[model samples]
Target: MTRTLSIAIKENIYRELRKLVGVGKISAFANRAIEKGLGELEKEQKREKEQLRQQLIEGYQKRTKNKELQKTLQVYGEIPNERNEYSLSMVGLPLTTDDLKKFLPVEVYIENTPTTGLDKPSKILCDSPFTWNKGIRFKKRLGVVSKEIIEKVKRT
Candidate 1:
């Protein structure tokens, strides 16, 4: 047995119900609409949560990577002080001039201080100067590259 109840609804809602009543029972139509709406809402909420989770994961990964890069640069003496030039002794594993060329798109400017000797250029320069625009544009690509490189290094 089925039970029926008469309930008052807003004018606009009643108008909408009237349209659907021609094709199906008002209760059935309303119940179907409510179920469909809930399903769509559930899907939207799940998508939003997943997006937030991914964003958080990416943010943490980026922060960790930046810290590691800073440490690596420090260990290799690649970090220049007030003086823009890097000492040859400081350029160590993973932080070589070649690595900078391969990884960074910006022009690598090593200001070599003059030494007491023949007037030959002190510093060696690469073929192409690094540019931030190039590197910045390729950030997403470089991020994938860096993650792979870090994982490989970690394993070794």
Candidate 2:
């Protein structure tokens, strides 16, 4: 099931997104972006919550070790987090956008046959991943070393 939603973006960003995804796939591209962002936020929230719980536990134990605060805190329902206790019941979430752009491949696939008067070559910022890091020249140098190692092992 899908619902219609409208959003406004800057003209330049919209143009860039269209070039990256397609003319009419803005909605799908936005959805994929949001989903990926949400996954990262969830993991970060989990990590922060665990860190906070540990801090609270440490604070409570330090207070209790004094002997006087221990009896006082015990009188009230509030206690240390040592018994696997947490104050936060609801999940709330909230990194690196720069590193992603550095390594990830940005590509566009052409499948349909070219139509007359509609196709033009566009200047792209980076070489296509399929061409950039492929073929004999780009293949691992480790292959030669591995072959030498294998030959040596066979002799032994």
lDDT of 2 by residue, 60-134 (tens): 556554554333211011112233133332111000122333432332221111421113321112232111101
Clashes (backbone N, CA, C under 3 Å), per candidate, total 7, 0
Quote the lDDT for 104 in model 2.
27
Using TM-score as the measure, the top candidate is: 2
Model 1 segments more than 4 A misplaced: 1-8, 66-156
Per-model TM against the reference: 0.35, 0.42
Residue 56 lDDT, candidate 2, scale 0-100: 63
